[model samples]
Target: MSLQIEMDDPARPDVLALLEEHLRNMHELSPPESVHALDVSRLKTPDITFWSVREGGLLLGCGALRQLSPEHGEIKSMRTPAALRRRGAGRAVLEHILVEAKRRAYTRLSLETGTPAAFDAARRLYESVGFRECGPFGDYRLDPYSVFMTLDLRPQTE
Candidate 1:
């Protein structure tokens, strides 16, 4: 399927619905305090750039890059519809976020995801793109239910 990824307004009805579903899923999978999924209002901040993936005008998935600093960024709200999993839509959104991070000259990209068995696929997907486990960053604190991952975007100096 031809997937198109574009910057999107998080306030739109369809986008809001998808984000709500994502938040609901996170709450179901993780403890209340451990859930860190951002709501639509937070995603509208200037620091966050949100994008949605669509095929034939149907929303397939969405993801975002939040600027942490000049050299750092955080991946947030990456979600593919349950019915559309394993169809490359999530991967496409992720790849697009990584490219956007690089274009913004971020030296590192990090993300926080659940550590439960339900998150295995997500961990594998991030690993496939070189994301490795790391300690919490940004405003995050140590939480057993959360797994932090990071990818270095800087070029090798050698």
Candidate 2:
């Protein structure tokens, strides 16, 4: 299936609805757990940028990269819509984000995901993309429910 991913204002109604659905489902997989789901208002902040992945007329997935500094970024709000999972939408969206990060000159990209069984698929995706386990980078503290990861983007050639 053909796919197109583009950076859009996270405030867009379609993107918000997709993110909300995925975030709600992710939280429900456990209990009332805190997993750093950025609200629409927080997502609209300047430091964070968002993208949506769509195939044909269907929204497949969405993700965001928040600028931590000139050389680093943090992956946020990554989710593949339920109807679009297992069809390479997640991988497509993830690779697009990584390419975007490198294009923006980010040397590193970090992420925090859950430790529950519900996250096994997501963890595999990250690992396949060269992300390795790492310590927390931002304001996060040690939490058993969360696992941190990072990937060093290859240097761009002239």
Candidate 3:
């Protein structure tokens, strides 16, 4: 499949629809108080960089990276439509975000996902990329419904 991913504006109609669906899914998987997915307005903030994955002019998936500090970033709003799952769209978007995080000199990248069975695939994706379980980061606090994961972007040393 020919996939093209680029930095995008979250306010675009297509992107807004995808993000709205993402928020709905997040709320479905976790309680409202535990749901942290950003809405269109939050995604458009200066500290957040958004990207959309497309194939042949159709949106495949989207993700965002929010800078938490000079050396740290948070993965946010990663979602591929149900019909688009298992097609590498999610991984492509994630890898693109990881590359951008490193390009921006971020030393660590973290994400918060739900602990429900509906999120098992997402957890596996993050694990496959070397993101291990971690405690809450940024302004997040401990929560039973949330699973936090992080990856260190520093070069490995022998």
What clash count goes with each model? Answer: 0, 0, 0
- Predicted candidate 1 versus true structure: per-residue lDDT over 28-53, tens digit per residue: 98889999999999999999999999
TM-score of each predicted structure versus truth: 0.97, 0.90, 0.97
Error of 1 at 74 (Å): 0.2
Which tens-of-lDDT digit does each residue in 1-158 have in candidate 2? Answer: 68888888776777888878876876786456556888888988989888888888678888889999999999998888776688777888789889889999898999999988989999999999899999988888777888999998866589
The whole-model lDDT of each prediction reads 0.94, 0.85, 0.92
Which residue pairs of candidate 1 clash? none
Error of 2 at 5 (Å): 0.5
Instruction: Superpose all Cα atoms of candidate 2 onto the true structure and report the RMSD in Å to 1 decimal.
Output: 2.4
Off by over 4 Å in 1: none
Error of 2 at 139 (Å): 0.9
**Candidate 3 residue spans exceeding 4 A from truth:** none
